[model samples]
Target: NVMNVIISKKSGQPTTMKLNGVVSTSYSDSAFKFNKDFAISTDTTTFTLEVTWRMIDAEDGSAYDSTDTNSFKIVRSTRVNQPSEGYLDCWERDLFLQFNGKPINAINETMNKLEVVFTTNSDRYKKVSVDITHKSGSTKDSLLALPLSENDSGFSGFFEREVGAPKRDNVLQHSDPDSIILIYRNPDNPLDTIRKAYPFAISKILKFPAASYFDKNADGKVDSIFIEVEGPVDQEDLEKLKSSITLPEPRKFKVNSISVVKGGIALDVTEQSNEIRTYVSPTDKIIVNSGSLPAGGLIEGNIINVQDKVAPVLLSGTFFSDRQDSLQVEFSEPVKHFSSKEPILFSHGGKTYRVELAENGVFSKERFYTSKVISVESGSAITEGDLIWINPAAGIGDTLGIKQLNPENRRVPLKVQEAEYEITVRTVNNPMKPDKPVPPEVVNVFGEKGKKVPPNGVVIVVEPKGEIKNKIKMDEGKVSIYDVVKHLVKKDIEGVFDEGTQKLYFIWDGTNEKKRVVGTGTYNAVIRATTISQKTNNRKTFSQIVPLGVKRK
Candidate 1:
C-alpha cells in the first residue's frame, strides 16, 4: 500500500500545505500502522492533516483508494513568558520561585511530570522533579502555582517542588546560574520535546551580618539589637530566621519586627530574659544558622559599658546675700543636666515662689552646685523657718545620664541669718585722751562736743551682728577707712573685733597718711565694713559716714 500525507494551516483562505510526505505501510492482524517524521512551521495556529491511501490486490488486479482529512489545533510551546526574580531563604534552605505566564498545558494528565534544571556557572546542573495533577478549575490561559510546602507530594498543573538537601547544597556551593531550562515531553510523540530557557537570577541571598545593641536612654542597658542582612526577608520567613539565631545561655532575646534600612533589612530585637543585666556579652558568640550566610558565625560587637546607676544626692544648700541673694545647692557628684516638670518651690511668709536653677559659675571638681537667686513676687523676705525644696518631678541628670529620684520635699539646708549682717556706727571725741572722759555719740548726728574735737583724733566704733565675727577677712587690699578733710585721705587701719563686746573699733588720727596734722576744719570719716561668711566665704560690704568738726588747739 502507498500513502501520502499533507498538512496545511486553517485560515480565512485555504493556504498552501506547509508539510507533505509519502510513506509505504504494511498490515498486521487486520490493523495498519505507519510512522512518519516531518517538521511544521511554529507560526501555524491551526492545521489540517490530509492522508490518501491506494491498495492493489495481487491476483484480481483491482485498486482501491481512500482519503481522510482531520483538523488539529496547534498550541504554543511550553515557555516562561513572564519569569520574575527568585530569592533564597537561607534559614529554611528553600528557593522561592515567583514566575508566571507559563503555558497551562505544560504539565497535564498525559504529560504529568515536569523537570526544571538549574545550571550553575560551573556547568553543574540540578534537576527538580515536579509531580503535576489535573485540577477542575484551572485557568485555560496560564497556571498560577501556589507556594509549595515541604510535605506537598503532588501539585496542580504548575511547577512547585521543595528542593532536596543534597541538590540545594551542591547548587549553593557554586555561583548562581544565568538561566534555567524547563523540559517537557509529549506523551504521544516522545520525539517531540519542549525545552524553554528563561533568565534565572537568584537576586537576593539572605545573610546575617554583625549585629549591634542600642541603649535608647543611655542607661547602659541594651534596648534593642539590630541585625543587618543583604536581602529583603518576607514576613512568613521571619519566624524561621528568628529561630535560627542562637544566643548564649541565660541571655534571651525576641525578634520583634523586620524593616528595610539603607543597605538591607534590619531585625529589631529586644531582651526578653534579663532587665538589669545586658542581653548579650562581648565574649558571647551570636551564631546564625543559615545556608546562604557564612558558616563561621556573626562578628561580635563591643559590649555596652556599665554606667553609674546611683542617682545624685542633694548634699547641702547655702543661702547667699552677697551681690545677689541666691540659694546654692550642692550635689554629691557632677551633674550633667537637670529639669523640672513643675517649679522648684520656696515658701516665704506663707507665699510660694518659683526658683529657676542654673549651672554655677564657679567650678568644683569634687561636687556639682546649681545656684538660683531667690526672689519673691510679693516682696516677702526669705527668712528662717521658710521652706526651700525641690519638686518631686525634678530630674537632676548626672554625668552618666542617671536622673535623681524622689527629690520631692527634699529640703535644702539654708541659714538665711548667716548671710545677713547688721552694722551700727558710733563716734567718740578725743578718743586718744581716754582719761578726759569723752562720751560716746551716735555717728549719724554731729553734737557740740562730739563734732568740735581738739584736732587730735576721733574714735569710730563698728558693731556688726550675725555670723561675721572672726570670718571677716578683707580681700584685694580694700581700705576700711577714708577720712575726707577737704581732701581724700585713705588710712590703712586694722580693727579688731572684740568678741566680748561684739564690737569692732578703729581710731582715725587728725593727721593724714603723711603724718601731718590737718588744719582746723570739719572732716567726714567714711567707714566701710566688709564681712565674709564662714559657711560660704562670701563677702558683703556696709558703709557709713561720720562728720566731725576739728578745732586747732
Candidate 2:
C-alpha cells in the first residue's frame, strides 16, 4: 500500500511530505516524515493534513486503487511551558514521537519528530525485529529497545507515551505485518532500569502442524481440531497461538463473516515423542458438504502443514433388485472388515441396520484402489430416498490406511415405476409476443408420478394453424406421431423434477434451423412423456396436447 501526505495552510501552497515508514513491500507500513524545513510554521495553528493511499499489485505495478482521501485535522495542541526541544506530541493514538528540543505545540511538530520503525519480510513464517534509531535521541534505554517478536515490546514505549501504545502485540509471530508490535516505556527524569532489562529474542520462527477432524455424528460438519509442534512450546508463543488461532464458521463458498464459537471448549494440550499437541472441541459444529473443509484459518498463522490434509470422498454404491435384500458399496480405500458380528453396522432414519455377507460378498485386502466391494443383505426393503451412512466405529479407512475420523455418507435415490402416468402442457405462450425476434419462453410440462421418467422423456411437435387436415391415428395408450412433422429438437427432451414439489418444468424457445423463429401462427402442441420400467428397463410413454398462439408484435 502506498500513501501520499499533503500539509496545507489557508491560502498557501500545499506541501507534499514523505513518510519514513516501509511501503509497497506488501506487508509492512512505516511512518511518514518530512525534512526539518518542511515543518509547518509554528505560528500557523489551523491547517489540514490529507492522506491518499492505494494498494499496488505486487505481481505487476497495476493497482486496484481507490479515489478517496482520508483527512485529519492537526487539532490545536495546548501550549505547555517547557524547554525548546522538550515538548510532548502525539499522532492520533498508536504512534508517539518526542522531538528532543521542540516545544509542545502543533505546527513545528512536522516530520522533525523521530518515528520508531519496525520491518519484516513476507506474510508468513519469518524472523522479525524492531528498529528505533530512526535518528538517535536523548533516551538511551528507548534507543536500545528492539522488537522481541512481532507482538512483543521493550522499552520503546517510554519515548512515545504521548502517542498511544501499539494495540497489536503479535505482528512478528506470523508472516503478516498487520499485527501491532508494542514497545517498553520508561521515564526520562527518574529513569527506571527494571523495565530496561526486559529481555526478548528478535528473530525466531517455530514451524508447526495443524489438522481438522470430521464431526462424529455425520451431521455434515467439522467439530474437532488439532495442532502439533516439535518439542516443548515457548510460553509466549503458546499464548500468541491461542489468541491468534480462531475457528471460523464452516462454509462451502467464500464469505467474510466470522465470530468466535461462544461457550466453546478450551483447547487441550498433550506431549508425545518430543512433540507438543493441542486439541479443541467446539461448542458448536461447522456444517459442510462432501469435500475438504477449509483450512485457511490455520494456514494464515503458518501453523498448518500442507501435507497433512484429509479429503472425504464417496466411491460407489448401487442397488440390485435381483436380490431384493442386497446392496453393494465400494470405497476408494480398504475398510476394516465387519461380518455378521457387529449389530449396529449401518444407520439410516435414526435406525441401525444389521449387515450379513451376501453370497457374492468380497473383502479385498488392498489399500488404495481397493476391490473390497461390500455386499450386505438387510431385512428391510430399501425404498426411495434411502440414504445410509456407515458408523466410523465400524472401521472405514482413509487412503493412508488409517481409520477415517468421519467417512463420507452414502446417498441412495431409488428409481421406481408408478402404475399410472400423466402428462400435460403446464404452460406455454398464448398469442406470444417475440422480443428480439423470438425470445425463448418456457413451455412447462408436468409428469405425474414421473419418478421413473426417462431422459428425453417428453417429445413435442408444433403443428401450424390448419395443418391437421384429418384426425391422426390414435391408440388406447399411444399417439401415432406421423412423419408429416418432426419434433423441433431431434434429441431427447431434458427436464428437472422436484420430488418434494412434484413439479416438472420444460423449456421451448421456438427457434430452430437457421435460428429462425416459427412464423406467427395459431398452433396445436402435442407433448409425450416417456419412461422406462425400473425392474425390466422397458419403455413406457404417455401423451397429451395443448393449444399455442404466437404474435410477432
Candidate 3:
C-alpha cells in the first residue's frame, strides 16, 4: 500500500498513528494539520451537510448552513469582453437583467433550488461592478452592455436610470388666500421651478394633469399600488427643521353671519325693492355692521393657515424711505386691529413716525378723529394710518395727516385697545337742555331690543347718536318745527294727555345727538313701551319710526 498515515484506537490503549502503513507509529500534529487544509470529500450522493458552532453568548444553538461567512461568486461567461472580442448587448436589450430571478447575470454563492439558507450576518450587502475594457491593442473604443433596470425583491419597483426622477405632481394646490395669482413649483424638478402658475383670470384654461398612472396596470385591474410612503418626521432633513420651526397654536375661528341687503348686494337698500335676507347657519350668528358684507359670500378659514414672516422696517433712520413721514407694517398675517397704530408709516418710503390718536393733537382732550376739524368744522375725521404730511412752517415736527393709498395693501397694524363705541351728538332744541333726563340704553348682544317688564311703571330705552345735550328738534326743511315737536310740548311740558299719538309715538322733527337739528338730520332714536314679537324683528329689532322731520323752528 502507498505510504499513508492512519490514526487508530485499541482497547485499553492510547491513540496512535501508523506511518508508511507499518509499525512504530509516531503520531504527528503536522499530518493532522495537512488533513484540515483540504476540503472533506465523500462518495457522490444526494445528501446534506450542516455546520454548527456555539456563539459567544447563546449556547446549545445549532448553526445553519447559511451561517457560514465564507461565500463564492458565479459570474456570467460573457459579463465583460473587449470590443475586439465581441460586444454583448443582451443586458441592455432585456429588462429581466434588472430583476432578481432565474437566468441571473451574477450569483453570490452555489445553492440547490428552493434551499433555505440562514445567515449569521443579518446585515449583508451584495454589490457588483462591471468593467468592460473598451480599448485593446489596435482596436479602441468599445461599448458596454449596461443594465437598463435593477430590482430588489424587498421593493416593488426596480431602480432604473432611463426612467429618470419621479414625475412631479402637475396639479397645484392653492396656497395663497388673498393672491389673485397662484404661484408654486413642480415637485420633481431639482431646481424647484414653477411648472405652471395659474392666474385667476385663466382658471378655465388650466386642467389637472391626467392621473392614469395612479390606476393599476398591474393584475389587469384596479389595485392599490405598493408605495413606500414616508412621513415628514421620517425624512432625513426633517430633524433640522424641528429646532427651527415654531408651530403656532390652533385657534377656533368663530364665523359671524353676514347681513344681506336688498336687490342682491345693492349699493342702496332704500327703494323698497327686492330684499336679500341673511341666512345664518347653526355655527354662525349675525353681526350687524355699518359697512357692507362681501358680495362673493363668506370664505372658509381653514384655507388660511398660520403665517409667520418678517418684513424690514425703518425704526428711526431714512433708509429706503419716501419721507420722514409714513410707513407700512408688513406683517406675516393681516393684523386684527388695523389703522390704529400709535405710529403710522409711508408705504412708498420706509419711515417711522409718531402719531396723535387723540383729538388733543398731542395736547387735546378729544381722541382719534374727533380732535380733527372733521369732527367740528367740515366734520371730516382722520382715522389712524392717514398720511400725515408736515408743512415746513407748521414746525419741524408738525405732522399734518393727508389721504393716501395703502401700499401693497400693507396697511398699518391696528392698535388693539379696550373695546368701546363712539357716539356723535348732532342736534337738540335751544331751551330744554337740563330737562332731558334719560338713562343710557343697553343694547342687547344683537344691537337691538329691550327687556319685558311688569305693569304700572313705564320705561324708555333710547339709542341716541350721542348724549342728548338738550331737547331734540329738527330745522326748517330740516326735521324741526313740526306737529311731533308741538305734541311733545303739549304733553311733556304741561304734563297732560295731549294726544293719542304722543302716548305711543317718539316723534321728532329730525334731530341728532347734539340737539342741533339740520336739514340733513340722520338720527338713531329708540323708544320703549309695550311691544310684541310681531312689532320687533322676531325678537331682533325693537322700535319703528314716523320720520323724525325737524321743520324750520
Candidate 4:
C-alpha cells in the first residue's frame, strides 16, 4: 500500500510526500512530519491539502484499481493556537458595501449586471477589492483602484473620494465567462485572515437603473434623487445623468376648474399635472399658465391642490342697520386675525377710521356667506362708504400660514348707503288699563312687551313698511345686508314679537341711551328701535326712530 499527501499555501502549488505502508494486527501507527519546517510565512494566511490512497494486491502485481484523492483547506484561527506556538489574532475586517445608497440584499439587484460595488467603512484597510464567483466554479475577483477618469469633474457628490488616500480598484471582475461570483478581498494584509465573502448573485438581471426621489418631510412622495457614484462630474454630465435616470413617468396633469372670481381664488386640482415628471408632491398646488380668462369666465379641466397664496379678500361685508356698532365681513377663506394685531384703517370721504375688534372681540372660527366670517364690533362707528383696509401691512394669512397678498383688494368698500330709519313715538296719558288675560302657568321667559307702562315716557311702536320679518338682501347668493329689529331706545330688545300683530311696542324713560335726562326744552324722545336677528350680531341699529314731547310738571 502507498499513502501520499500534498500540502501547499492556499493560493500556491502543493508539495507531495509518498510513504510505504504494511499490514498490522489490531493497532497500527505511523508518524511522519514534513522535512521542511512549516513556518507561518508573512504572505501565507491559509493552506490546502490533497490526500491520495491506493492498495495493490502484491501477489498478483495486477493492482486492483482502488485509488482515491481528496482535497481540503484549513484556515488559521487565533483562539485555536497552542501555548507553545506564537499566534496572532488576525480577524477579517468588516467592509460595508452598498449599491445606490441601499444596503445590498439577496433580493435587490443592481442596475448594471456588470457592476459590483464596494464601500470601505473604515480607513484601516490600505486596499479594498472584490471577487465575482460563478456557480460554475470560476471567480473574477480583482482589486479596485478608485477615482475613475470621470471623477475629474464635479460629480464627486455621488461618491466622495478621500483625498491623500490610496486609489480604489474596480472590483467587477468579468474574466470568468461561465458564471459570475461576488468575492471581496483585502489582499495586502499579512494577517492570517481570509477575505469577507459577500454572497451575491449576478445572473438573469435587468439592464436598466431605477430612480426614486426622497421626501425630507415624508408628507407624501419623494423630494430628491441622491446619486452615489465614485467620481466628479460637471453640470452637463449631471444633466445627462439626471435625464438618463429612469423613473416612472409622472402622470399627466389637467386643470380642474379655472374661473375669474371677485373674491378668493383657487386652482382646484383633481390630479397632478404632467409637467411634473418626477413625483406628485402633496405640497404642490398651483401652476401659473400663460393664457388669460376674462372676468366671470369659467374654465374646467383637472384640478391640483395648492396653498392659498392670495390675499384676504372681502367677498361681502355689511354693517347692521344705521348703527356703526357691529359689522360682518366674509372672506374667501379662514383668515388670520391680522386686523386685530395691525392697524385696520377705514377711509370714508376725507376722514380715516382705525377699525379694530369691538369690546365683544373677534372669533377664530366663524363663517358667513358660505365662507369664513369676521363679525367685528367697531371701536368707533363705521358709517357708509367707509373703505376698510384689513391689515394694510399684509399680516393676514390662511390656515396653512401663507400670507395674504395684493394690498389694494383687502379693503372693504362700504358701497351700499346707510339704511334709512324711521321711528314714531307717542306719549299716552293713561298709565293703567284692564290687565290683559294671561295664560296661567305659562311664564314669559322674555319679559312682557309694553308692561309697567311709563306714564310720561314715550310708547314707541315700530311697524315695518313691508312684511319685514327677516329681510335678507343678497347679491349673487351672498347676503348684501341682513336687516331686522334690533331694539327700542332705553329698553332691552326682545326677540319674540307677535308676527300676527305686526306692531312692536317699546316703553322707555325720556332719556338717551346713556340714561342722561334732558333739559325742559321740547326734546324729541327718540325711541331707538333696532332691526331683528341682529342680536347675535349685536350692534346699535334702529329700524325706526320716534320723537315725543314731555311737559315739565
Predicted structure with the largest TM-score when compared to the true one: 1
- Largest lDDT belongs to which candidate? 1
Which candidate, 1 or 3, has the higher lDDT? Answer: 1
User: Which regions of candidate 4 deviate over 4 angstroms?
Assistant: 1-314, 334-343, 347-353, 361-365, 368-389, 392-414, 421-553
Question: Runs in model 3 with CA error above 4 Å?
Answer: 1-342, 346-381, 384-409, 412-479, 483-553
Candidate 2 lDDT over 1-553, as tens digits, reads 1131121111122223222221222222223444333344455443333433454655785755333334332333467455495555321112233335332222121222333323223233233233332111212122334433343331122233212223333211211112222332323321111110111221233334444443343332333444444323443333445555544332222222222232222233221222111112242232221111121111123423212223233344444443243455545444445443321134446555554434334555442121221344445433334454445554554444545445444333333223343333444334455442211221222344232322221223322123221122211122222112444422233444433333334434444345446666554545555543333243445566555555665
Model 2 clashes, total count: 23
**For model 2, what is the error of residue 247's alpha carbon versus the real structure, in angstroms, after optimal superposition?**
11
Instruction: Provide the overall lDDT of each model, using Cα atoms, as 2-decimal numbers.
Output: 0.45, 0.34, 0.22, 0.35
Off by over 4 Å in 2: 1-212, 216-224, 229-303, 306-316, 323-326, 330-355, 359-379, 391-393, 399-401, 404-553
RMSD value for candidate 2? 28.1
Could you list the CA RMSD of all candidates, in the order they appear?
A: 21.5, 28.1, 27.5, 23.0
TM-score to true structure, per model? 0.31, 0.30, 0.18, 0.25
Q: By lDDT, highest first, what's the ranking?
A: 1, 4, 2, 3
